[model samples]
Target chain A: MEEGKGEVKHMLLAKFKEEVSEQQIEDCIKQYANLVNLIPSMKSFRWGRDVSQENLHQGITHVFESTFESTQGVAEYLSHPDHEAYGNILRPLLEKAITVDYHPTPVQL
Target chain B: MEEGKGEVKHMLLAKFKEEVSEQQIEDCIKQYANLVNLIPSMKSFRWGRDVSQENLHQGITHVFESTFESTQGVAEYLSHPDHEAYGNILRPLLEKAITVDYHPTPVQL
Candidate 1:
């Protein structure tokens, strides 16, 4: 593992309260879609809500996938006010979650 | 398209500068491993740097995999000072990156 170098992925998962309104849900979905799609290094993106009666994917509010060139790449994305605004909007119902950051060590070199 | 609910995955890709040293590398890897592994709902985890000779994963510092029950679930993870401290240590060499939040909408009710 080199000292100041390596690839890293930030993975996050979140939940919301049960009494959320429909209008707020619509707004969040629309806004989040546009935001994730607009990033330059976002290789791909996906999102949706948990609606399983059996609760197979229970309690999950959203799932996203996007890749950046470097840790700085993620910083740039997080710095956008647009992103912050959405976080503010969704801040109310957020429940339990996790975010892990890591990078691989050089194998052959 | 539900209004205020869905499963979301926060994914991030990062890059760092090329001048990193070895001790810092040890510090980050050990700490990050413990953090990610300790989360309660953490289903799975992965991390690594971009070291492919063919440059397949170029510029990527880390890649992590984890699932949360809700947006709120993620909040708990981010609020911890331990996580934040690592970010502080890692703040210097971080280069470029992107973080996408998403969820799988419940289909069958």
Candidate 2:
């Protein structure tokens, strides 16, 4: 975790289209993981398919979490060509999507 | 960033009650953060308030992300006494809440 550098998190929660297979979702996630390696402004990226049967998710079935150096980093990631390409591939498969971004302050217990 | 240990992510996104002040929300987030330091199974925890005016979020105001060693680690964190206490404080303040948990797989683009 990088401290005091205006760290921000970008998160996505989505449900896949009924026709989208599990393997396709895995492929899409891998594509996103690869973007982290290529994007210097992205501090960290992790994604996963929902494995829980819990009611708390309200139908959300997958999640992607990424930490960027700052809001600017977030903008750069959003506009990056690779991200655009990935989004094109992902959009059709997403039945529903929600995104949230925030600046993370250190939590001192 | 632990590898090959059945890493799982737990995420929460919520909107606060109409009367809940921003400071109260921040305080609640800090309490949750402190639990990370106390819980042996919680590998990492980070949180922030939604800074975007983007329509994508659909009213969700905050997010919390935590990584655990495995599903068991997640169960342990959920059942911890500190978590229960914190939830009691949080539940009343939340107008809406959504949680998602998943086992993260490495994305090999």
Clashing pairs in 2: none
lDDT by residue (A36-109, candidate 1, tens digit) is 65665433334444322222233455543334567776666667676678768766756644344345332222
Calculate candidate 1's fnat.
Answer: 0.22
Task: Please give, as one word, the docking class of candidate 2.
Answer: medium
Best by TM-score: 2
Model 1: CA > 4 A from native: A1-109, B1-7, B21-27, B37-43, B50-59, B104-109
DockQ of 2: 0.53
lDDT digits (tens) for residues B1-109 of candidate 2? 3233487878888999989987787777777888877889988787777865347898998778787878888888888888888889999999989999877555544
Give fnat, all candidates: 0.22, 0.69
Q: After superposition, how far is residue A45 of candidate 1 from its true place, in Å?
A: 9.4
Q: In order, how many clashes per candidate? A: 72, 0
Q: Candidate 2, residues A1-109: lDDT per residue as tens digits?
A: 3223487878888999999987897777777788888888887777776765347998888888787878888889888888888889999999999999877556655
Residue B79, candidate 2: Cα error in Å is 2.5
Off by over 4 Å in 2: A1-5, A37-40, B1-5, B37-39
